[model samples]
Target: MKILQIINSLDTGGAEKLILETIPLFNKRNVQTDLAVLNGFDYPFLKILKKLNCCSIFSLGNKSVYNPFLIFKIRPLLKNYDIVHVHIFPSLYWVALAKMLSFSKVKLVYTEHSTSNNRRKRFIFKILDKFIYSFYSKIITISPEVDTNIKAHLKYNNDKFVLVQNGINLDTIKNEKPISKKELLPNLENDSYILTQVSSFRYPKDQKTVIKSLKKLNDNVVLVLIGDGPLRNECEVLVEELNLSKRVFFLGIRMDVINILKASDIIILSSHHEGLSLSSVEGMASEKPFIASDAPGLGDIVRNAGILFPINDDSSLAKEISKLLENSEHYQETVTKCLKRANDYSIDKTITKEINLYKSLLEK
Candidate 1:
């Protein structure tokens, strides 16, 4: 079967990374897969996708959101594939319109990657979203929270939505030697307790809370942020204002994130919200004790595996890190539990479920 995966951009994020990891699995099953991005950008993942023979990449040119020409550009391409799977927002708008305009017979599938979209609450968008979703053969939610969120807003049948938890490629992060502090950041002291958070600086991702927690933690602890975004400047200023220049390190957009995860003593995610965070799962798969905000998507993944602190509570976060740092047995137990939990969301299991879903829909 031929599948076309569409997204707004091929930039870095959980959805993009998950889709990239998933392409090879589809190919292994002798399924032809291709990717389409509304706007083009150079990213590390693009290089990885180029190496996969089973995949072909396409772009709708560097088009603006207002570009009415986009639908015409994508319409012809939709006919060649048996299924068109869309990820991320706005792509939904374009795909919904293209499917209508072209009268395409291809199966339309969508994965709602987030638990919340504020636009869903608006009345105009409510009508638009309902209409858009009606064209979808099935809606795959990355977590139960996402499923519940969609049902709350969109007028879709219960049978229309399917729960397919996001999974990670364990091999990508496993069995890597962690680069030492001296190698990456020489300013860090020999005894510094590494606390890492790998996420883009944006809303719902409260890196500020993590930054604040650093001031309360022991001086021996260092906070390493692994991704970059709009809120980065604000985060940088907060780090300076807290006088944590040496204590907090911002290593912006590194391709070698797994190695950074390997170097960390523990991983923490201080997010206001999430839908099964890839960073948390990757940390768990890296054999490190994962600490995360006790919010819906994150809580679901870290429940029996690692530690959780109340959202935006820096004291609670600091305490969890300190406790784990002080106790070797507790730390090891958490690590073991995390690895086990990570196994549940392996790429192999995710691929099997996805392929089965696609085949079942095609059979009908």
Candidate 2:
């Protein structure tokens, strides 16, 4: 069977990363998986996918990710695959509309990647979302929180919803050698501690909280922010205004994320909410003491295994980081728990479930 995974862009995000990691594995199973994007930008993930040369890549030939006119362009592409699996917004709506307009028999599958979004805040979007979601044969949720939230938002109960938490290739992370501390931060002392957060500066992500928390920590502690988005400039200004220009490093986007994660003393994810953050899982798999905000998607994964602070509470976050630093035994224990938890969500297991779901849908 042939499958086509559609998304807005191969930018720096969990959903985009999922597509990059899964496409090759799907093809290896002889499922003939491919990819299509609404916006064909020259992002770092797009470059990596091209280098892999594992599957065909299709672009809608538009720079803008959310052109309503994309529906017309996507309609024709729907006929070429047995299943068209979609991720993220605008692309989800566009592909659903495209399926309805073309009257294609191909099944449409959507992976809901977040527990919350702006669209859900408005009453009018509830109606619009229900209509759009009706077009899909199955909706895969990345976490239990995501599944429950989407069901409540739609106010519909049905068998179409499936729980399949996001996964990462653990072996890749384990095998990658950590970049030396000197190379990562030349100005800092060799014994200085590094706190890394690998997430795009988007609305759902709270890099500001992380930045504020850094002020509470000791001067020897440094913060490294990876990934980029519209809010990155605003974050830079905050770092400058807070006089943390020297302490905070904005690395933008880097392909060697696993290596950086390995080199860090602690991994952090201060997000407002998540639909099972792949970064959180990756941080855990990197064998670091993962610290995250006690938000829905994140809290569920991090509570017992890693560390969780009150949402947006920089003081509490600072205290948690201090605890890890002060107690070596506690730090090692947290790392052991996180590494064990990370093993539960292996990429191989997730892909097997996804492949079965696709096969089951087609059989019907």
Candidate 3:
């Protein structure tokens, strides 16, 4: 099964990272995998993909990919690969056009990675996603929340939406030395309670919420920020303004997130929305409890193991963080439950599901 995976850019977002992590876990078995990027830019993940020796391709994109010129290029490319898998924003829109225009007999699969609450957007997205999205042979969503949206949008073939709970490959971290815990998380004594977070430093993420929450906490606590984006400067200012400069460390665009999570005392997720937080999964797998912003998909992730505070509610977030800090037994219990829950979203489970879907589509 020759497969082509198309994404926007090889940035360090959860959806992009999941695709990078997934390529290695999949059994190639004469099934060659090709990766294509539309909005191409050189990113750190390219080196990682090369390290795995995976098939990687990038396009300057045809007049921004929404034009008819796209079909001339992408359609022919689709005919070369037996299966075409598309991810997130532009990929979903462009892949639908490519599949329909090609008239090529190949499987088209889309994995939805986010949730939307804007009711105004609901109609537009529903129409566009439902009409143009019909080219897909199968629809895969990382979170069940997306399934609900898919059902509402596409009245026909609603059953195509399958949930694949984003999974973590723990073996990648366990055997390796994990980038020397000190190097990734330096100058920290055992007495310090380290709180780690890994998310693209973007607006919806609101790392400021985490920073504001931490501002009210005691001096013994340290906050580690990972991933980089437009909001990094804004977050730095917030940390400085809150006088958390000494306590907060912004480790931008980290390649060793799992190592940082493994070394930290607990993980915290402040994302305003998530399909399935792979970061949260990594934290749970590392046997740590998490505090997350209460949002649709995120609420589902923190249901049993972590505490959920209202989105953008810094006061509530601070109160919950303080609660976890004060009660050792509560933290321990949450960690145990989180670890157990993380097992349910294992790479073994997700890989099996994804492969089966690929094979099923091939048979058709």
Candidate 4:
């Protein structure tokens, strides 16, 4: 089978990371995979993809999604593949046009990677989505919450939507050697509780609240903020303002997440919204006591395995962190449940479902 996965770019977001992870698994199944970027930029993940030696990556060389040139570039490309799987916004709209313009018979698939699309609530976009979404043969959502959110907008496209849980590759971190706290952050004392949040500094991700909560916790508690984005500078300013420069460490854009998660005492996801957080699952797979915000996508995943607090409540977050740090029994119970939850989202399960889906589509 030949499949082409298209997205905005090869950035370090959840959807981009999932595609990078999935393409290699497809190669192992004797399927050929390719990727096309609507708006091109050089990213660290491109190096990772080269090493994996799976997907043949291409770029349309357009800086903006609004560029009309994308249709011409994407149209001809679709003819070479049996399936074209698109992710993220703008790219979906572009491909919808390309599929029509090119007259390609290749099956089109889409995965709605967010719990909600903010534009869907607008009257104009609601009508536009109904037309654009008709191009796809299948539509996948990373979680049940994401599935429901998409259904609310594309009422007629409900039959095309499928719920596929985002999966983690357990074996990748299985034998990872954890870096010590002293190694991770210089001059950091022993016996410190590390509360880490692995997400880019973007909307819905409340890393500022995590930093604020650090002031409420004991002096020995340190907060680790991984990933970087536009809000990173603002988060850094807040850290300094709260006099938490020593207690909070910003490790920007890391590839050593497995080791980092392994070394941490606890994991937290303080997002205002999410679409089945892969970071939460990764932390859970590492057997850490995870805490997260009670938002749509995140709450759905962490309800059974991890602790959930009210959205943006730094004091509640602080109390939860303290409780986990103080009670060994509670921590141990959370660890056990986390491992079980992680198993449910294994890479094996996700790939099997995807392969079956592809086979079913081809048969039709």
Candidate 4: where is the Cα deviation over 4 Å? none
Candidate 1 C-alpha error for residue 267, in Å:
0.4
The TM-score values for the models, in the order shown, are: 0.97, 0.98, 0.90, 0.97
lDDT tens per residue, model 1, 225-245: 988889999999999999999
> Cα miss at 357, model 1 (Å)?
1.2
- In model 3, the Cα lDDT at residue 214 comes to 78
Residue pairs with clashing backbones, model 1: none
Alpha-carbon RMSD, candidate 1: 1.3
| Candidate 3 deviant stretches above 4 angstroms | 28-30, 56-71, 117-125, 176-191
lDDT (tens digit, per residue) of candidate 3 on 3-66? 8888877888878777787776663545567788775566788668867786756564634544
User: How do the residues 246-349 of candidate 2 rate in per-residue lDDT, one tens digit apiece?
Assistant: 88999999999999999999999998899989999999999899999999898889889999999989999999999999999999999999999999889998
- Global lDDT of each model? 0.87, 0.92, 0.77, 0.87
Clashing pairs in 2: none
- RMSD to the hidden true structure, all candidates: 1.3, 1.0, 2.6, 1.3
Rate residue 193 of model 1 by lDDT. Answer: 87
Misplaced by over 4 Å in model 1 are: 63-68
